[model samples]
Target: MIKLYIKQAFYQLRENRLISLVSIIGTALAICMIMVIVLVLEVRITDCVPEVNR
Candidate 1:
């Protein structure tokens, strides 16, 4: 059952290569944006803290 589902998914992905590519790119961009935001916030927070706390 799982194998059949996997096969179907693969076929669908192959059939809609452009769509799959777009989806992958969109997901990657979203992940990158979130990571950048988190890193920026972390840096700002650490910078605001006193050096004595480090």
Candidate 2:
């Protein structure tokens, strides 16, 4: 099942500390990149109304 596959993946990640660290860092970077893109889009498309801005 999916649980078994996830458990095996975790076991392998733990067995290789360097790979695990890189994986963690890469995931974090990806999340940060997504957030940055969202912020940029919001800034670019936001309404410029006085009430909304205030």
Candidate 3:
């Protein structure tokens, strides 16, 4: 079953290389943007705390 699934995946990849590339690029960009936003929010939250309380 796994072998059959792999074969089908390869066939589709060969048949639609451009579509596959675009999908990968779009997913990567989305993940990168999400990480950047999360990191910025984390830094801002941490920086807002006053150091004298600690």
Candidate 4:
């Protein structure tokens, strides 16, 4: 069940604190990097034209 899987993950994270911290930070950094890239692409495509607004 999902509960068991979550409990197992919690225990694993608790047992290896350093590894868990590193893994969590890495995942967060990767997600943030992806979001920044997506935002940059959106801005570049939407706001790059000068004559569109004026």
Candidate 5:
């Protein structure tokens, strides 16, 4: 089940501290980069004011 997977993950993290730290930091950075890219695209594609002509 999901609980078993989580328990195993914690055990691995505790067993390998350096690898766990690197992987956790890498995952966080990747997530932040993706979010920034999506937000930038959203701002560029949306219009704040009305356009009179096409």
Candidate 6:
């Protein structure tokens, strides 16, 4: 069941605190980096004219 999976995940995270912290941070950083890259590409594609407001 989903509840059992959630409980097991929490137990593992608690048992491996350092690894959990690292994994959480790494996932967050990767998400942030991807967001930044997408934002940059969007800006470049949309802001073709210098005087236009987006």
> Between 3 and 5, whose TM-score is larger?
5
What are the clash counts of all predictions, listed in order? Answer: 0, 0, 0, 0, 0, 0
User: Model 5 over residues 1-54: C-alpha lDDT tens digits?
Assistant: 999999999999999999999999999999999999999999999886778456
TM agreement with the true structure for every prediction: 0.74, 0.72, 0.73, 0.84, 0.82, 0.85
Worst 10 residues of 2 by lDDT: 45-54
Worst 10 residues of 5 by lDDT: 45-54
Count clashing pairs, candidate 3. Answer: 0
Q: What do the candidate models score in CA lDDT, each in turn?
A: 0.92, 0.93, 0.92, 0.94, 0.96, 0.95
Error of 3 at 29 (Å): 0.5
The C-alpha stretches of model 5 lying farther than 4 A from their native spots are 50-54
Model 2 lDDT per residue over 1-54, tens place: 999999999898889989989989999999999999999999889886769845
Candidate 6 colliding pairs: none
Q: Give lDDT tens digits, candidate 1, residues 1-54.
A: 999999998998999999988998999999999999999998887766468665
Best by lDDT: 5
Better of 2 and 6 by lDDT: 6
Model 3: residues >4 Å from true position, as ranges? Answer: 1-3, 48-51
**Which candidate number maximizes TM-score?**
6
lDDT of 4 at 39: 94
Question: What local lDDT does model 1 show for residue 27?
Answer: 99
Where does candidate 6 stray beyond 4 Å?
Answer: 48-54
TM-score of 4: 0.84
Best-to-worst order by TM-score is: 6, 4, 5, 1, 3, 2
Model 1 TM-score relative to the real fold = 0.74
TM-score of 5: 0.82
Report the lDDT of model 5 for residue 11. Answer: 100
lDDT of 4 by residue, 1-54 (tens): 999999999999999999999999999999999999999999888866679866
